[model samples]
Each structure stands twice: as structure tokens, then as C-alpha cells.
Target: MAPNMADDVNRAVSGARPRLIVGISGASGVAYGVRTLDALNDLGVESHLVVSRAAAMTLSQETTLSLAELNDKASVVHKIGDVGASVSSGSFRTLGMVVAPCSVRTMSEIATGVTSTLLTRAADVTLKERRRLVLMVRETPLHLGHLRTLTALAEMGAVIAPPLPALYAKPASIEAMIDQSVGRMLDLFGLDWAPVRRWQGMAADAPE
Candidate 1:
């Protein structure tokens, strides 16, 4: 069942909604980022978003959402080069950061402290503050470099989650699959979601 927006917003304002910072990289699964923002908005969570240049290209390719439409989903949106953003400071309190559809290039840059832009810098701040950092890496056929970078980030306490769907959830549509993956990513930072189905064993007395 879909959550009640009004009630969820109220709960989000009260205690459930963590001050969240969402970053979108240049990956193919732009839908995951859109669904994540929608989920957060439904929960009344205040969000700060940063969209990379490459993300804009991918968004044009992957989804119908216009730049304006995408920005509307967040409470605040920052340019990728906005170094003056609040999320760049350690004093600016946030529950954590999520990089949906995190590209391999982005992952390597973050893992190596290459803060060439605001998104990378904010991720750096997230690590320095020891807050939760979830990267939904969207790559297949992982090579040695990809594995090495992911391992390094994991050692530094980043949750390296790939956008892999679960068949057990019985998703009926593409949107459902995206929701399930993004919902699980949010769960890492203690966000509550009911849109994604949890794992449950098969029924009793099954034929064997």
C-alpha cells in the first residue's frame, strides 16, 4: 500500500525525515534518482539535491522528466559547481547522503577524495562527518578498478549498493523495481518506507 502523504509529511517533520542530500551522477538509471526524490518528498523529508552535468545527459536519455520537473521534487536544488552550498560544510547537519545511480567514475573520484565539484565535495564532507553515505552504483560486469574503488569506499564506511532488483518482491512494473531498490537505499539511513516489499519465506506446505 502507498503511504499517506499528509501523515508521512507530518511524521517526517517531527522525527522521521532525515536532513537528506541527494546526488545524481552520470549513470543510465536516472529513474532511480527520480523515484528516490519522490519517495522522500512523499515522506515530507526536506532534501538538497545536486545534479551533475553527466546526469543531465543521462536524464535526457533515460527519462521524460525535464530539468524543471526534476528540480520541483526537491525542497532545494544546487548546481554541481555550487561550492557554497550548505552541504559542503561539516557544521551543516544532515542525516546522510545518497548518490543514486552512482557512476563508476564518480565512485572512484569520491573514494579518492577528488572534490572537483560540489557533489564530490559534499560527499567528502559526509565522510569527514562520519555520516552514512550510500552509493547506488549502476554498473555491470565489474572490472578490477570498479571492485577496488568500491572496496575502498566500503572500508571508509560507505554503503556501496548497486541498483539490482529483487524478484521475490514481485514487482509488476519498471517503476516498482526502481522504487524497491531506492527504498532499500533509504533504509540504510533509517528512513521508513512501505512501497518496497520485504523478504518473506514461501508459504507452508509447499509441494516438494
Candidate 2:
């Protein structure tokens, strides 16, 4: 192949790399977000991470890793307040957005279209652009209001995927369990990760 043609092909392939927006809100199980970034890196997907202020505090409280280290895991880290960032625009193509360990406050804000931060703004852009918006909502013991908000989000095409462990996968450790859930979330974007143990099937006549 000609040198110029080879160079053009390389540029095309580089430009076609898949991108996804990852949001980490102030919720427990921040490991989910951390592992999501790790998985994306493994899959060669460009991850645009936006960490909320409350999530920053949660990260400090829950993990020994510094915020700088967390940011380094992502391909691009956008400021929480940078609403004008590329991710906040619909024209910026991406696979979609995932709010790992999504806080109820963040979910509610996205559902209402009242995005107060770049994280939520990117989510709103995802929804408006008809792109997949997956929410790994962490709150449990949902009341009527929380349920209603989640329903509204679902109705508007947001995926409500809580990070539930696939006990069937029989995760040997907490990290394995977290990887299983993060793998499932990535599946929604059609990016398969190695940690996801695929369910084959039970023996037809072995058990009830």
C-alpha cells in the first residue's frame, strides 16, 4: 500500500474508536465506576468520565485511592462543572452514557432534564440524542417517589440497571462480583468484557 494511503487508513481507524461517557455520582459501591473505567480501558473504548463533587467525597471516604489516580484510569476526564464540555453536546458522538453507582439525586435530576452539572448534562444529551443511557442506580428500599422517578426515566428510554450481583456466576470474591456487574453494564453498550461469565444453560433433564 502507498505510504499516504496507509496513513489515511490509520487515521480512519483511530477516529472510529468507540466512546462512552461514564458518570460517578455520590453513591456507595464506587468500585462499580472504577471497574467500569478499567473494563473500558481493556476493551479499548474511549471513556469520558465526569465525577460529581459528592462522588469525589464518596471516593475519598470509601477508597484509599486518590482522585487523581481515579481520573488517570479514564481516557478523558471532564470537570464536573464543565457543562460546555464536548460530552455535554449531542453532536459529540458516543456509544452512550452510564452513571455507575448512580445516586438517586443524580437519577432524579437526569429524569427531570434539570441537569445541574456536566455529568447530568451529558446524560441529558445522551437521552436527547436517542442514545443509550444506562443508570446503575445504587439506592435500595425505594419509596413511592424514587420508584416514580425511576419509572419516568425508564419511560423516557433510560435503562435502569442496578448493579446486582449475578450469584449464578458464583463470583469467588467481591472484586469478581463487581466485575461481573460492570461487565453486564458494558454489555448494554455491546462491548463484551472477559469477566462476564456467559450463561449457557442448565442440563435439560438434570434438575427441576
How do the predictions measure up, each by TM-score? 0.90, 0.92
Q: On a 0 to 1 TM-score scale, where does candidate 1 land against the true structure?
A: 0.90
Candidate 2 stretches with Cα past 4 Å from truth are 1-14
List, residue by residue over 154-184, the lDDT tens digit for candidate 2.
Answer: 9888899999989989989999999999999
RMSD list, candidates in order: 5.7, 6.7
Over all chains combined, what TM-score does candidate 2 have?
A: 0.92
- Across 25-135, the per-residue lDDT of candidate 1 in tens digits comes to 998898888888998888777889999999999999988888989999998999998899898997776777899989988888899998798998999888877777889
Q: Find the candidate with the highest lDDT and give its number.
A: 2
